[model samples]
Target: MSKFAKAGVAKKVMDEARKPQNQQKIKSAISNFTNKNKGGGTGAKPR
Candidate 1:
């Protein structure tokens, strides 16, 4: 796609992300992802 098309898509995404509900959803998703990865360990077995 052209640069203009990319810019338009980015604008639309920014507008959608500016909404209160969308912001909350994004925050919740990030929080859940971080929580899920917290204290994760490598796959190595204990000696």
Candidate 2:
């Protein structure tokens, strides 16, 4: 997946992690996926 997908997944995961019905795995995995690939990749690269 791309960096954007990573960020999006992180947000959704964190939101789910806040709920009590969610598993502890979600909470633990939060730190693993969140902010790991944040950067200015949203723009086109200069070639």
Candidate 3:
């Protein structure tokens, strides 16, 4: 209920929401794996 506690909580939440440096690399790896192994895009394949 105090201002200090509220500020600390808000700062923690904001920090968590900020993307880390490795996020893009991780995302790209996942995307590449899915594409190579499972046809990653959103399209219907001919049977």
Candidate 4:
């Protein structure tokens, strides 16, 4: 949906894509996985 020819449609699509529920679900899933993997050396500095 290119905004050049259809601004309203593009705006609607982008708005839906940026919804709170969708963003929260994505962030929650990432955090859940990250917490599960919190341990020795997933992203830690070597000693």
Candidate 5:
């Protein structure tokens, strides 16, 4: 897409993310994602 179209999309996203309800939803979604991935391990095996 063109720069103008990209700018419009970015503006719309920023507008949505600025709302209190959307902000709470975003925070919860991020926290849930992190909570689910907290037990990740490295690829190396134990010696």
Candidate 6:
């Protein structure tokens, strides 16, 4: 797995990895983990 700190899409990658239903969607995690951006961390969204 890619380093969460290095990747800009930590939340997107981790959130996808944490779900059980995403077992067959491992590629999604890779995609998110590799995504590049200049934005800051994506903290939990307010309810």
Most TM-score-accurate candidate: 5
For candidate 6, write residues 1-47 as lDDT tens digits.
56865585877778887888786578666677677432367755558
Best of the two (3, 5) by lDDT: 5
Residue-pair clashes per candidate? 0, 0, 0, 0, 0, 0
- Candidate 1 residue 6 C-alpha distance from true site, Å: 0.6
The weakest ten consecutive residues by lDDT in model 6 span 36-45
Model 2, span 1-47: residue lDDT tens: 99999999999978987887686676567766664545458656869
- Compared with the true structure, the alpha-carbon lDDT of candidate 3 equals 0.77
Q: What is the C-alpha lDDT of each candidate?
A: 0.91, 0.75, 0.77, 0.81, 0.91, 0.69
Rank by TM-score, highest first. 5, 1, 4, 2, 3, 6
Q: RMSD (Cα, Å) of candidate 1?
A: 4.0
TM-score of each: 0.74, 0.42, 0.40, 0.42, 0.76, 0.30
Residue pairs that clash (backbone atoms under 3 angstroms), model 6? none
Better of 1 and 6 by TM-score: 1
How well is each residue in 21-46 modelled by candidate 5, as lDDT tens digits?
Answer: 99999999999988776756744565
**Candidate 5 deviation (Cα RMSD):** 4.3
User: Number of clashing pairs, model 4?
Assistant: 0
- Which structure is stronger by TM-score: 2 or 4? 4
